[model samples]
Target chain A: MSFSIDQILRGDIPRVERPPAADPSLVPVRLRVNGQDHDLQLEPRVSLLDALREFIGLTGTKKGCNQGACGACTVLVEGERVNSCLTFAIMHQGKDITTIEGLGTPDALHPLQAAFIEHDGYQCGYCTPGQICSAVAMLKEVEHGDASHVTSDLMATDVQLTDEEIRERMSGNVCRCGAYLGIVDSIRAVYEQQKGQ
Target chain B: MRAFTYTQATDASAALHAALQNPEAKYIGGGTNLVDLMREEVERPNEVIDINALPFSQIEVLPDGGVRLGALARNSHTANHPLVRQRYPVLAQAMLSAASPQLRNLATNAGNLLQRTRCYYFYDTTAPCNKRQPGSGCAAIHGVNRIHAILGTSEQCIATHPSDMAVALAALEAVVQVQGANGTRRIAMEEFHRLPGDHPEQDTTLGRDELITSIDLPALPSTANSLYFKVRERPSFAFALVSVAAVLELEGEQIKNVRLALGGVAHKPWRARTAEEALLGKPATAENFRQAAEAELQTAIAYEHNAFKIELAKRTIVRALLTLAERQLLA
Candidate 1:
């Protein structure tokens, strides 16, 4: 279900040849998901979350709202976390994608995964994957000195990762089970460990 | 969702050509809004043109002491860009106060400017919404419309523009660079988005076949004391209930210059030109700020559930201006 640039453009190598009006409903999309490339023939309207969960057989990413309102479908695309439900599968051509499945294994867990378990970060576990993925990116953002909405001084070059900052940054992923305290503790543990390392 | 054809365009002209080829085709940059609408069946495009690869992601410094921002630049990137953060802190704060970080990372400058309203009726296809389908009666007129517009609304629609960035742009007087079938032209941000007078279906002044290539911001050095204050139902990931973007310049005690624009109140960004005019040479005091807010909101017409917005908008404006004035004192 994958097509080269030529097959997509429907002509010679360089010039783009518009495909005829035959079977334009489905497009051949190639996705690199969780360190694996998957060739999926999908409808143009299929979301990236659907392509990952249904097409690629990866169900780690949860679909809470199926809209961008909730961060349940968060996934790292090209090292940046984005809402998978809000983007088309065909848009991500050759980008690096990392899902919750790629985060850790049963025997060996990522620090965030271990901290979540220790801190009891999940009561229902529906938003754990998105929470972990978003926390991973949030750490990188803090390391890069990216300020959050709660950051008082916009001109400050250095931003310390406070509890308020973590809460504000992780506000996208809503845990309906009221496990916010546990989630905050888990993220803080990981941040502290990263700084120590 | 309905099936559609998809194609990727590497340049701006190619994307415009594809859009011209199919009248029902839509150019998708981040797809944060359009993709959701397509899933809800509110928007059914026969073709979707991918324009993410266009070289419109750079933040350029114009020779005439201005900034030119490419259309494809992500919201997070633009908000955090050194030039924007330093020169236009209000714009940065506005963008930061918008949707979640993940969305801001994916939403582009042009897409943010062109995002549709988040009215529940507008998103619910089963409900009657003239913005979603022209000639369809507006359900928000009598339905649960706590989030409906209170200013610049017509009988046809009460939907408000949902972009926090647009409010700041309107206050800063940014210009939109559009490339259409005819040619390239620049549209002032003030005149770029139109009010829902008779036709609520048409959102912005962007033509059906036009592509927004970039946005140009004229230098406002006095806007160093600018800020964006947003009040939402929740702290994050929610649209503004009443947001204000204010820029203040003070000479000793009197106000030298001021700019004000409001969100969640109208079909477009409600620029407080009257407020700015009233506070031009007035003293930088809370009383003057309140008077300016009242002067700008004189023509406001609020619906049943949204009458509180008039008072809320006025308080937010005064608060924003007073905060900026206090910052000037501290500086």
Candidate 2:
């Protein structure tokens, strides 16, 4: 707890700059993408959403607010959805990440993706990917018995998602195209399919 | 924002050591609150100590029939935890009623409690806010008094803590576990937040080097029934204008016990302790609840824009109490 001013002022420490953090061409950063290992070099302040789209070549995620206000930049990090835009690219090192591109493709669509296509869940398709990803995660959340604002019985042990549940759970995502009717229908369709309806 | 050095703490002790070494460092968990503050230029730390990966992510059952919540535990995970849902239903409700699914998933338990006020002036750097810049003067005092405090207001600051979960914890007598250079200490939930007084810049009584490790909540009586009610302009995902968390233990048709706490109207969650004194051993009637609600709000001094919160909170408390009283009959 004590230090001598004379010794501190001596300051015989070496100012050695050892090695570089990343390659000169690209900044080194680690990210777990689609259950796979991803190490990339990018700018220090790049957003997770933008880094995913530009550097990782995954464009399924859309950019709406760039801020945390909208859910357009939502993605699953360790099975939980978060706004990628609000997060830094470097923060997600070694964490399991699942994006909409990882959900499915045109050849083999995820259930939520297929449900959206079948239910005509989108118009102009701006918010569709984000909506599909959110629904996919939401169904899993409900299946795990997570409660929502409208989930009446917190004590039920087995929570059932009513329409109100779906609405409240998905309030973060805004469909500026007024495509919410179809979006809700698509989520309902997927829910019914998962329920064996 | 200028690039700051990144430091990741391997464990709790390491985190404490790092924090002690760098007094200008701030802990980063989920980056939900810190990132926005950085974006708004409200806070610019010289170093960010990433404590999200610390091994304190588990929610454990204390030996005394209580719960020990990890600091890094996200809001959604804690809200959905089995013990939280069963034993602390009000906490679950309050957590679920916070930000949307995405935000709740990323928001950590410690970050949520340590979050700064959402006052417009604090975020807008140009506006004068004593909390944001000490002695700058509070523009929010008269500029836009809406969404400000009523219970613990001072001329220097009028901001409110924006966590419904904190409100529930305040009512339940939660204890905050923090680690500092001198070691670990427990802070009572009620005292975790400081009232706006002569020093508006000091948000918490904690020293700059202290870091929250976890929050431990003592077990309430299992027979107690609780509920949370938030009055908002819109239905879902809006901040509470006035929220009430009430717990009632009824004996037959009469109220044997009552515990009340209110949010969105104070610097911290306002515990209706004085009001609860009046409701104990009273009949389970709307009149009793109305009286109790009025008794609690008697001390509230509201501003021009937020004066409506006084009435809205009264109605919220009454309805919350009556609703629980009715549910007690069925249980």
Candidate 3:
């Protein structure tokens, strides 16, 4: 009745039969996560966050304030960041979902992850995955010339990642440890390193 | 969350047909607010229809220069669209000021317009909220109501609309395109959202079967010189206490045209027509802006916990207009 995350990632599980729309039974959901395909039979209301943790067994994405108030469940969908808790698993069938576990492993950490350890970006570390995941997409957003609430020049194609800009962009993730100074430093470090490259 | 059936509609007609077949079916796009409400048992639909497959996610520019935002377009995409950022910067600013980046990435433009209030009483099922259950009585009227509405409030509900993008859309005088079994039609932005009068349960004028297709922003050169000012409990990631969206056009030293809308102060976006009229043909000065703001807030009623909102709203309006005027001078 249960399968390991590795087995599921290896396509050991066959796709389940998709139930009719009128049937109130558990519907079949196909999710491609971190370049792996997962077929799960779930209720219509299962959130993407729950599906990732409970069904797919990728529990790195923390669930904080399941009502989308906090960003502990932040994940990348098609290279863009979103709160996994706020969306339904059935809704993201075709999108590419990237959770914290999908990011660089312990052996080869994502640049932000490496920078987080160097800068001590977390204390309890519950919000670290979400913060790092959010920072990963936040850098891409800025590189794509996306403006924030704090951005004064809306029409500018070039965006400068100031301290205020990073704080505003990462406001969704709440850290009880008050490790924002380190979080900002980690993101800035990676940002500067990337810019220099 | 209740057990429900799920269906992904391939087209608009199919979505409408499925909705017509199931009375308890809810069409979901983004699901940022709907899914949360469903988890809280605030919304219980027997069936959930996925409308993401429909081709209503494009951000197109009309031949007349106005922008057409597809109802299903993500908030982050719509806000960052070059047309919206260059010509409708106020809307971009308002949307960016409202939610976190993660939320903006998932939330859609039409869903933002249809989002319910952030009133504490409405969210707490234990509390009596007329908006949640009609005729249940309102708890926020006497309870903690610092975030309640100050304008267009009835005894049944004092909740304010929690949308910064809608406030900017109201100031821009956008139009909403909707389709139902009866066919397609458009509703003005000012008429799209309804005030909570005797019936607090109804949030908008949109019918249950009507599906919002797109939002059309009218081409206005004045919107180029616009600003969105939001005052929240925190620097970011909080609902607005008093937000102002101002579009100002200056003719020499006089105000040629002005559109003002106030958010976090009303059941719907409060279009400051009185203030717009007051500032029309007047000198573009800080004193005049203050007078116009006061005129707009003359009829704003406040509750016990939110009397400061009235003053805050007026000051924010004046500040927004003054900022826009200063920007015009520099330009």
> How many residue pairs collide in each prediction?
0, 1, 0
Docking class of 2: acceptable
lDDT: worst 10-residue window of model 3 chain B:
B118-127
What tens digits encode model 3's per-residue C-alpha lDDT throughout B27-70? 99988899878877788898899998899999998899889999
User: Which residue pairs in candidate 2 collide?
Assistant: A27-A41
Summarize candidate 2's per-residue lDDT along A1-197 as a digit string, tens digits.
22233432342222222243353334588898998777897655567898899889888899876667678888988777888987878788888889998999789999888887887888888878778778888888988888887788887757677777888999988787888877888898888878995
> Model 2: what is its DockQ?
0.28
Model 1 off-target regions past 4 Å?
Answer: A1-25
Deviation (Å) of A86 in candidate 3: 0.8
* lDDT, candidate 3, at B292: 86
lDDT of each residue in B1-331, candidate 2, tens digit only: 4355677788878887887887777788888888767655688776778887788789999999999999899999999898998998899999999888998998999888888888877876757899999999998787666788888789898898888999898888899998887888999988898888978788777777687889998988888999888878788877888999888899998888788888898777788897899888989899988898888889889787889988998899999988999899988
- Give the number of the best model, judged by DockQ: 3
Where does candidate 2 chain A have its weakest 10-residue lDDT segment?
A11-20
Least accurate 10 contiguous residues by lDDT in model 1 chain A: A11-20
Q: Per-candidate TM vs. native? A: 0.94, 0.92, 0.95
lDDT of 3: 0.90
